[model samples]
Target: MTEFEHMLVNSFNTYIEENGIRAISYRLKQHRFTPQFLDVLVDSLNPDLYLGIECKSISVDKGANALYFSQHFTVDKNGIHQIERISNYLNKSGRRGFLAVELRLGTGHGREAYMIPWNELKKKYFDKDLKLTLQEIRSFPEIKREGKNYRVDPMEWERK
Candidate 1:
């Protein structure tokens, strides 16, 4: 797992334990590529609690803005693109999905993290240019990292 994935896994685990969320979540195995190109998976007896998260981290210039979600799209050997595959899986399984993106803004500047909802990403996927400026992403919930853990509250989106 990449450093961000590892940290995200730890974050989710911590949240599950502390918040008493009865869900089993883990970071997916990574060897060149994951089957679904997903970084984290959460399974639960409650349908509302089930989730699949794809983690992305990008290093940008100090003043750089915008997170071109399409820039991360990739076609697998079977000609399936990442967005289509993940979207299909979550829809068929009736699970919530999110994109956990982190923007690394140079040394000592820290990173900006956001947990973007799947529907938001889906809307952008159909667009000619899937680019969301930082100001736009700010409309979504920001993820906070306390120490080494990330504060992600899926319920905040689930109940909506």
Candidate 2:
């Protein structure tokens, strides 16, 4: 992981602890072959609150207000969607699939994070297999970004 990615993950870990949430994050290296696996797994006493997160990070242009998430597909492969496949798995397993989006500022001063649920994302925003914008994601706030930081709240989960 790059230094920024490392910083995001570490900050997320600290957020998890401060919130008293039971969660664990797996490195991509361990699950590269299994694209259906999530980057982070969050479990709760209330089964309905479980979450599967796919962490994604990108640095936008200066003063950029929005970012996009393109559905994972390889041009070389006929039909392979690593990211969407993971989302499908999490949804089918009775866990909410989420994108842990990290927005890095162009100046490298700070970063913003948001957790967007997959159901809302895929159903309304995703155009076929293209991209979803940050504006659509910001509508729902499982974790809200404040001055480049987001504090995750388990209580904000959308009860399925």
Candidate 3:
């Protein structure tokens, strides 16, 4: 993982702790054969919440809306289809499943950071009963740009 990625994971871990959520963040290593596995796996990472997060950081250009770039990293049709297969395997064994994405700012002017719900993945890959609720979850904080790296404070972003 890159330095910025490390910061984002740390921020997420802090968020889980502050919310009193029982969660663990697993940093996935590059696998030559299994590159599709999530970069991070959050297991039971929230209090009464089971979620999986896939994080991406993008550098924004001047005068551009950061959200525009957020959509690029989402689970595409193929990815969603793959997720369904995984979900099915988990569900057949009676396991809960979820997917989320955290979009953080990288560098340049007008750069901003935020989290976007992978609603497409949830709606298409998961059962209606297994869908995640964004209202019940906490939001991540804006990442700070220092030179070429970005930083986020997990405690500051914790839900009230």
* lDDT by residue (tens digit), candidate 1, 1-160: 8888788777777778897878878875556554744778888887766888888777766555777655666777898778888899888878789988888878777887888898888888777557777777667777887764677777665314
Candidate 3 structure quality by residue, lDDT tens digits, 58-102:
433323233222243345446654455545544453334333333
Cα shift from native, residue 85, model 2 (Å)? 0.9
Question: Per-residue lDDT tens digits of candidate 2, residues 1-160?
Answer: 5453454455556766776667643345554454437666656555645667777766655544554443332322446455556656876888877766666666656666666777765654445534656665455564555555455564574645
* lDDT, candidates in the order shown: 0.76, 0.58, 0.46
Q: What overall lDDT, based on C-alpha atoms, would model 3 receive against the true structure?
A: 0.46
Candidate with better lDDT, 1 vs 2: 1
Candidate 3 TM-score to native: 0.47
Collision count of model 3: 1
Candidate 1: regions farther than 4 A off? 32-34, 62-64, 158-160
* Runs in model 3 lying further than 4 Å from the true structure: 18-21, 45-48, 62-111, 121-160
Better of 1 and 2 by TM-score: 1
- Give me the overall lDDT of model 2: 0.58
Stretch of 10 with least lDDT, candidate 1:
28-37
Clashing pairs in 1: none
Estimated TM-score for each candidate: 0.86, 0.66, 0.47
Candidate 2 least-lDDT 10 residues: 67-76
